[model samples]
Target: MSASARVIRSAEFQAERAWGALPVAELDGVTVRLHWTDSPYIWHVNDGEEVFVVLDGQVCMKVREQGVEQVHWLQPGDIFHAREGCEHVAHPQGVARVLVVEREGSV
Candidate 1:
């Protein structure tokens, strides 16, 4: 199949609910998505690597290592990378827009 490139205005993006994601593109077996949220996401470990980018607003990323949980503050333009089996979650300060790339069907 052929693919066409287009522009996406992330600042103008919105979703019906918190943590809602808009499908962006698929490369090989990886999926790119735009997520809008005002709430926190559940802790999960991706089966594959994940790239998370904050496009708007702020987010607090919580990561669990060993038995300790750490907090990371993310602002616009900040990027977070989670390797496979890494436990983490994201909590939006208010409203936020994020770009995420991960293996398709991963949790």
Candidate 2:
């Protein structure tokens, strides 16, 4: 596999001036992405495990467990891990940047 070094200023990252993502890297069918958003994402369950890291700003993570919804506050440097089949959604307090790692094509 070929690899090169690069630098990403996460704080200054944006995609089309909208809430979206930028592909970072991939390894063994897993994908790493940098996402910027000021809105909430749809609630869905991942087909595989997911690792979400708050890179900048704040977010409120919501998970549905046993039909009960739970909410957790996330700040910069906080990490949230979602196992396969875990239903969850993320709501950004403002414009927030996040690093997400998961199986490619998973949603």
> Mind giving the per-residue lDDT tens digits that candidate 2 earns over 11-103?
889877535888999999999999999888999999999999999989999999999999999999999999999999999998899999999
**In model 1, which range of ten residues has the least summed lDDT?**
1-10
Model 2 residue 105 CA deviation in Å: 0.5
Model 1 clashes, total count: 0
What do the candidate models score in CA lDDT, each in turn? 0.94, 0.92
lDDT of 2 at 68: 100
Name the TM-score of candidate 1: 0.94
Tell me the tens digit of each residue's lDDT in model 1 across 1-107. Answer: 33566788899989999988899999999999999999999999999999999999999999999989999999999999999989999999999999999999986
Report how far off residue 11 is in candidate 1 (Å).
0.9
Q: Against the hidden reference, what TM-scores do the models get?
A: 0.94, 0.93
